[model samples]
Target chain A: MSIPVLTPNIAAALAADVYDTIEMPAGAEFTPATGVLKTFFDFSRQGGAIHGRSGGLLFRRDSGFAVIGKGKSLTPYANSIAIAFRGTQTGYDWLSNTNTRTVTIENQTQAHKGFYELFKSMRPAMEQQLNPLLRNNAHAIVHCAGHSLGGALAQLAAIWIKKFYGNKVALYTFGAPRVGLKNFALQAPGSVDATYRCIHGDDPVPLAPVWPYYHAPYNGQVVRLTADTGIRVSSHKMRKVPHCYQNSARGDWANLISRERLQRQVFLKREDHHKVTFSEYWMNQIWDALTTLLRQSGGASAFVFGLQGLGAGVHSFYDNLAIELEKSGMNQQHSVHLEGLLACMLAFAGKRVIRAIELTARFIRWVFRQVLSVLDRAVRQAIQQVK
Target chain B: MWHLQRSTLVCILVGLLALFTHNPAEAGMFGWFKRIDVQVSPEIKGAITLHDKPQADMVIKRGTFFEDSWSWDSTRTDADGHFYFAEKTVKAREVLHERQVAVRLLALDYPTKGDEDLFFRLSSSHNLKSRSSDLLTDGMHCELSAEYTMSYLKSLEYPNMDWHGFQSKCRFLHADKVIVSQAELDAAELEETWRGIHSLLAYITQNASEMDTDDFIRFHVRSSAESGLAMLHKIRELETDIDKLNTLPNFEKKFQHYLNKLNKEDQR
Candidate 1:
C-alpha cells in the first residue's frame, strides 16, 4: 500500500479549522472582523510554511481591519466572515527563494496627489466592515491563522488593528516575523498588549528583518518547543532530528502542543504581560557605556567620534543583547556592565591613536605659547635700549 | 661682573641646546621672509591717455597771480607706473574696458604724532607707455592725486560682486549721469534675480525626493528657463542703460549692443 499525499484542499481545510474553532460572537459583522483577523492569518500561513508548521493562529481586535492587505482594496460583504488559507509550499518557496530585487526611480512632485487617491479607495470597504461592529461599542475579538506567508501577514494586520482600535484588540502571532519599522513597534496601540510572537528557535522564518533592531511587540515569556525532525533541505539530505521539529508526522503534533502551551501562557499571564519591557529598552546602557569609554580615553572630542562609529553596529549589538537578557532574565545592571566592557574592547585600538595625537598637540602648543611670551619681552627690552 | 658673565655663558649654552633639540626652522635660507612682486599686464596698449585742458584762473593766493591749468584724464596708472590705452581715439569709442592694472607701493610715509601716526601720506605714481595700435586711446584731462589713485586700487581689490562691477561697466558705456544713478539703484536688483535662480536650484536638489516624476521633470524645465531669463534681463538692462549715456563713444555703444543681442539669442 502507498502512503497518501495531503491534498491542497485537505491541507487548507485543516488550516481553516484552526480558525473555525474560535467562536465569533452573535450579531458580529464578519467582514471587518475577518479583515482584521485576515492579517494574522496571512502572516501565519506565510510563517507556518517557512517553519513547516501545520498552521498558525493570529488574534487581534476589529479596528485595524483596513491595514491587513498589501493591496489598496478590501474584500466586500458586510458581516460575512472570510477565512483564506494558502498552502505552505508556496509560502516556503517565497521566503526561501532569495532572488528578489528592488529598483528605485526618481519621484516627481505631482505623484503625491495620486498616492492620496489610492489611499482613499480603500476607505469604503474598511468603513463598511468597521462601522457595524464599532457602532454597538461591543468588544470585538478577531482571530486569524495560517501556515507560512499567513504568519507574517498576521503580524502586520495585528499592528494595524492595534493602531486603529487602541485597547479594543489583542494580537497573537506564531512564528511571525518582526513587523513594522522601529517607530511603529514603539508607538503601536496599547490594545495590542496581548500581542505575542512565539518563535521555535531553529525555525528560520521568524528571524526575518521585520523589526530586527527595535523592540518587538512580544518581549517576554515566549514558550519554547522541541520538535523531532530536523529541517529538510531536500528529501535526500535528511539527518537525525534537530533540536526543534521540522515538518514530520510527529512534528505536527509537537507544533500543536507547543502552540497550546503558548496560548495558555498568554491567557494566564495576559494581565501582567504588559509590564514586560522590550529587550532593546536598554539603549541607554549602550549609550552610557560609550560615553564613559570616551571620557576615560580622550575627552569630549574622542567621545563624539567614537559615538559616530558605534552607529548601526552598536544598535544591533544592543538589540541582540537585550533579547539575550530577556531570555535569561538576567540582571540588567550586569548586562550593562558587560556592554560597557564590550564597547571598551571595540574602541580600545582607535582610542590609543586619538590620545597620542591630542597629547602631542597639547605639549607643542604649551611650549609655543611660552616661547612667544619670552620673545615679546626680549624684543621690548631691545627697543627700549635702542631708544 | 665675573659671576654675571658666567651666568650669561651658562644661559647661552642652555639656549643653544634647546634650539638644537627643537630645530624649529628646519628649512635653511629663505625661510624667514616671503617674496612678492606686482606687475601689470594688458590685453591691449595705449588704453589710457591724459586729458589736458586750459583753465581760466579762478583765485589768487593773497596778492600772487595764480592760474589753475591742471587737467585730468580717464587714464589710470598700473602698479609699475604704466598707463596703457584701450583705443586709438577716445572720441570715437563710446566706452573702454578698464584693463586690470596692478599697482604696488614703492614706499609709505608716516608722520609721527604724540603717540599717534597721521593717516595721510604721499606715494609716487608711474605710467607705462603702450606701443600697440589697439592700446591707443584719446587723452582725457585729469589730475592724478595720490589719494585718488589709492582709492581706485582699493575699490578694484574689493569690488562688490554685484553693484560695483555692474555700476563700473555701466559707467564705462553710458557715461550718462542719469544712467550712472540708475546703475547704482538697480545693481542689487540683478543680484537678487541671480539669488532667486540659485535658490530655486538648491530647493529642487534638497527636496527632490518629495517630488513625483512629473513634478520633478517640470521643476527642472522651469528652473532652467527662469535662470536663463534672469541672466538675459540683467545684461540687457545694463546694455540699454549704457546706450542712454551721452559721454560714451559710438564704438562702445555698438559693441555693447552686439553683446546684448548675443545674450538674448542665447537665452532663447
Candidate 2:
C-alpha cells in the first residue's frame, strides 16, 4: 500500500513534540499534568541527549508528547500520542547512535547496529517515563519523530512500541541518516507504517551512513520543507543561539492559520511552482568561487575537498543568517510559498558559508596560540646558530 | 616536520573543519515535484551478464525519493540480450516528485532459481530539467556489480492478477473510461462541495458490495462529474484491493484520458 504524505502542517505539529523535549533543560521534571509545551490533562517531559547516554528528553502532554520549542498549533496529530527526538547535542553527540554502514546487523535477524544501540540507550528512559504513558493511552497511535540521529532512534523506538504494545506506530524523521540496511528498512516488522522523513533544502544529515546504507528502506515517505531558515531545519544542531534567534524551527513550520479551520476551505488548491531566486544564483556563484579556491593544486585543497565531501552537497555551510533574516523580517512567510521557498533555500545556503567561516576563524585562533611558543624557540635556536 | 604543501595544508584545514561540525538536529523538509525523461542505453552493445552468461532481461522499478517503490517502466533484452528503453515519466505524476529508480537484473532461468531478482539501486538518477517538458533526459547508467546481493520477485503479484504493470495497462485498454484517485470527498469541506462528495461517497459505499469489478470499472469511471467518485465506487462495490487500482491495462493512455476528462469537466 502507498504511504500517505505528511503535510507540512502535520510535520510542524510533530516537530513541536520533539522540540519540546530537546529544548527542555536536562533537569526539568515532566508530568501530563504539567507538560513542558502543551497543557493537557496528562502532560510531562523526560529524557536528555547526555554525552555518554543514549537517551534524549521527550515531552508528553496527555496522549501527545512534546518538548520546548515555538509551537503554536496542535490539532493535526491530536489523537496520536507522540515522542520527538533530538539529532545530536554538544559533547555527547557520539552517544545518540552511530551507523556502522555495513548494511548488516549484529544479530542478523534483528535490526541494524545503530538502531539497536540507540534503542538500548533509550529503552530504559522510555520504559520508565513513556511506557506507562503508552499503557494508559493504548488506544492512541504511537508517533515517533526526530531530526538526524534522533530520527534513527525514532525508527527503532517505533518498531519496539509496535512490537510491545501491538499499537499502530507512525514515524516522521527529518534529515535523518540511514539507520540500517535496505532489507532492515524493507522487512522490519513495522517499517511499513505511516513514517515520513522530511528534508529541507540540501540539509546533509539525510545523506549519511553513505553508499549501500539507504535512508528510505522502511519506505517511509519523504516530505520537503522548502521554507528557509524562516523555517527551522537546522535549529536542532544550529550553534548560534547566543546570537538571539527567536521563533524556533517548530514555530517556523507551524501554520499561523490552523489546519482544521483551513480544512473547511480549499487546502491544497495551489501546488505552486518553485522559482529560482537571486539568492539561489548567488549561492552557485559563491560555490564556484569556493570550489576554485579549493581546486588549486595543493594537499590542503584535497583535504578541504575531502572534508567538504563529508557533508557539503551544495548548501552545506554554517552561519547565523537565519538570525539576520529573522531580525530583518525577510524570513517570515507563515505559510509555504513558491517565492518564499526559493528565498529560504538561498538564505540557507548563504548561512552555511557563514557558519564555515565562523568555525574556521575559531580554529585559526587556537592553532596560532598553540604554535606561538614553538615558533619562538625555533627562532632563538636559529639565531644562536648564526652567531 | 609539517609537509606544508598547499594541498597538504588544505587537507589539514579540512580535517580541522570536521572538529567544529555540529549536527543540524532540528531539520526542515520538503516534497519536490519532478518530471524526468529516463533513458537507458548500455555502455557497450551487450546486455548485462552474470557468471559470464548474458542475462536475459531487466526490469526497471521507479520509486520516489522516499516512499513506496512502483514500477514506472520496464524493458526486456532482444535475442542478442541487448535492449534499450527511454520514457518520459508521468508515472505518479499526480503525486510529488524527488524520485529514484531501481534496475532489476531479470534472469530468465528455468523455474526462476533460488536468488530471485537482483536489484542494483541507482540513487538520485533522474534530475528533471523542466516541469513543462517530461522529456528531460536523465542519463542513468546501471552498472551491474557483484556487490548487490539482495533478491526480490521480478514483478509485484496479486492473488488474481497479472504483473502490476500489465494488469494496470490492460484494464486501461479494456475500460471505456478510467478514474484516478485525486478528488477527495473528505477535502470537500464546503457545504455544497462537502454534501456532493459525502452523498457520492455514501451512495457508493452503501451499494458497493453488490457491484462487479469489471462492470464497475467500465461503467462508473465515466461518471458525469468526472471525479474519482466512480473509481471509489468501483473499490467499494468490488471490494478491490487499493494496490490493484492503478495496475490497469494501458495505464498511460487511460491516464491521459482521465486527465482529459478532468480537464474537460473543469472547462465546463
Candidate 3:
C-alpha cells in the first residue's frame, strides 16, 4: 500500500500526453517534473456548472485541479505517491469558514470537504478506470492545486487519501488555511516528505487566524510570493469579475509558479530525476490523466469564458483584441464573420446622427482655426498699407 | 417616400432593441464618492499628533451596495504622523439617503498598553459601544484602558535563571497591588498582561538596538519629562542600563561624551 515513486522521463512523458489532449484557451503552459508543474484550469463561462454553484462561490471553485507525483523514491518504483490541495482567496467569505459542521458562517465550508469526500469515495472508481493503464505500475502520487478554496480542498483530499491508503499519501498545497486542529499535520504519514504549503507575501487568507499554522509542527515549505500588483486601480473602479480570480492574471499564482520553478532548479539534485521508474511514471500519468479530465470537462472551459468576459468588461482593449485574434487563428471562418459583422455595425453607426454631430463639432473647430489665421494676415496687411 | 419612411422606422426600432439587449443598466454620467479618515498613533510620550489632515475616501454609484464601494482617495500621514480628511462633497444625489452608517477603520493601534504609574486611553469619535454594557454605561462606548509595567528581565535574551527569578518577583508585585480584598487577576488576564509587557519590552529592545547612545538618552529624558513619579522611577532604572554601558571599554568614550554634551546644554 506504499505510494510509488516516479522517474523524470516517465513523469515528463505523462505530462506531455496530458497537455496534448487538454484544451486550455488561456494559453497557460505546463512545465512538469521540474519540482513544479503548472496547468491552467479555464472555467470562465461554463455557467458556473463545475461546482453546481454560481455567483461569488463560482469564483471560489472556478480555477482548481489536482497534481499527482511520487515522493522521495529509493528506486522511483518504491517511492510513495503524494497529493496536496490549495486554499481559498484571502478575504473571501467561503474561505473564512473553518468549522466542520454548519456553524455561524457565510458560505458552506463543507462543500469543499464534500468535494474531497466525493473524490475519495470515487477513488476506487478512479482506480478502476486507471488500473488497466496502471495495474502493473508503481505507487500513485496525487496532488490538488488551487489558489484560494481549491488550495483548502487539495489539503483536505491529501489528508483523506492518506487515511484511506495509509502511509502512501502526502499533501502539497499553497495559501491553504488550517482546516483542522494542529494535530492534523501530525496525523499525516510521510507528512514531512509529502507536504509542502507555500504562501505569497501578505496574502490575507494565510494571515487570518494566523496562529494555527504558526504554532503547528508541520514540516511543509512555506513560500512568500510578491504581493504588489504593479498596476494600481481604485477599489471603487474595481468590479468583481464573476469568479474571485483577478481580472488580470498578474498576481500570486504567476509569482508562485516562477519562484517554485527557480527553487526546484536551485535545490533539487539531478540524481533525483534518474531515480524514477517506469511503473512510477505510468502511475503519475494516470494521476495526470485524472487531473486533465477534471480540468478539461469543467475547469478550463469555465476559465476561458470567465477570462474573456473579464477582458471585455475591464476595457482591457489589448487583452480583448488578443483573445479575439487567438480565437480567429483557431477558427478562421467564424472570426472573419465576427469581424465583418462588427465592421458593418461600426459603419452604420458612423453614418447616423451621433456621428454627424461629432463630425460637425470637428469641422467647426477647424473652420474657427482657419478664420483666426486669416484675420491675423489681414491685420498685418492693413498695417503695411497704412505705412 | 412612404416605403423609405417605413424602412427608416424599422431600422430605428431594431437599433433601440440592440441597445437595450447589449446593456440593461445604462452607465451613469455622474459618479458618487465618499471619504473616510482613520487615525492611529501610540499614546506614548513624544508621539506627536498633528492636525494636518490626510484624506481617505471610497467611491460608489448612488444605488450600489456599501460593501461594493471603492477607495477613490487615500492620503499618507504628515510629518507628525497625523492624517486629515478634507471636506468632500459627493456629486451623486442618490447615495445620500442613508443615515447612521457604520465606518470601520483599520487602525494600527487598536489596543494600547502602559505601566502601573502611567495609563493609556483610546478615544474615537465613532462612539463605539461595548458589547458588555447596556443601560449603565451610556457614553462609555468601546474605550479600552489598560495599565501595565514592562521589564526586559523576563525576555529570552536573559538567562533562564534570571528570567525565572524576575518573573517570580513580578508575580509577587502584581499580587501585592490588588486593591480589592477578594479581587484577583485570572490566568487569562495574567497571560494577557504578560503578552502586553512582552510586546512593549520587545519594542524598547528593538528601538534601543537601532538608536544612537545620545538618542537613547534623549528618549529616556523625554519619557521622564512626561511621566508621573512611578514612571520617573522606572525611567531612572532604565537610565542605569545606559550607565552600565560605561563599564564596556569600547562604549565608555561615546557614553561619557554624550553625557558631557547634555550637561553643557543644561548649564547653558
Number of the top-ranking candidate, with lDDT as the measure: 2
Per-model TM against the reference: 0.24, 0.33, 0.25
Q: Flag regions of model 2 displaced more than 4 Å.
A: A1-7, A16-27, A30-42, A45-78, A91-115, A133-138, A188-192, A218-220, A227-387, B1-268
Candidate 2, overall lDDT?
0.35
| Better by TM-score, candidate 2 or 1 | 2
Q: Which stretches of candidate 3 lie over 4 Å from their true place?
A: A1-92, A97-140, A166-170, A189-192, A209-221, A225-387, B1-268
**Candidate 1 Cα misplacement greater than 4 A, ranges:** A1-134, A165-167, A210-215, A227-387, B1-268
Please give, for residues A1-387, the per-residue lDDT of candidate 3 as tens digits: 112222221222222212111111122332231111211121111211112121243342222233333322112122223232222212233332221211111111222333344244334433333343234432343433333344455555554444444334334433344443334444443432244344433233443221122211244344433344211111100001111122222222223332221111111121222332212122232223322322332332343334311112211322333343333332344333333322222222221112221212233233223322222222222111111
lDDT of 3 by residue, B1-268 (tens): 9999999999999987676334211111112222332222111111112122321221111111122231333344345443333322232222111111111212233233231111112211111121211111111111113222221112122111111000001112222222111222133223222232233233333444333454433443322222222222333333334553343343323334444555666687
Evaluated on the second chain alone, the candidates' TM-scores are: 0.22, 0.26, 0.18
- Quote the RMSD, in angstroms, for model 1: 34.4
Question: What lDDT score goes with residue B60 in model 2?
Answer: 31
Q: Could you give the candidate ranking by TM-score, starting with the highest?
A: 2, 3, 1
Which digits, one per residue and each the tens of the lDDT, describe model 1 over residues A168-238? Answer: 34333444433333333445434244433443443333433311222244233333333422211111100
Q: Interface RMSD values for the candidates, listed in order? A: 38.5, 25.5, 31.8
Model 2 lDDT at residue A324: 25
User: In model 2, what lDDT does residue A245 have?
Assistant: 12
- Window of ten residues with lowest summed lDDT in model 3 chain B: B161-170
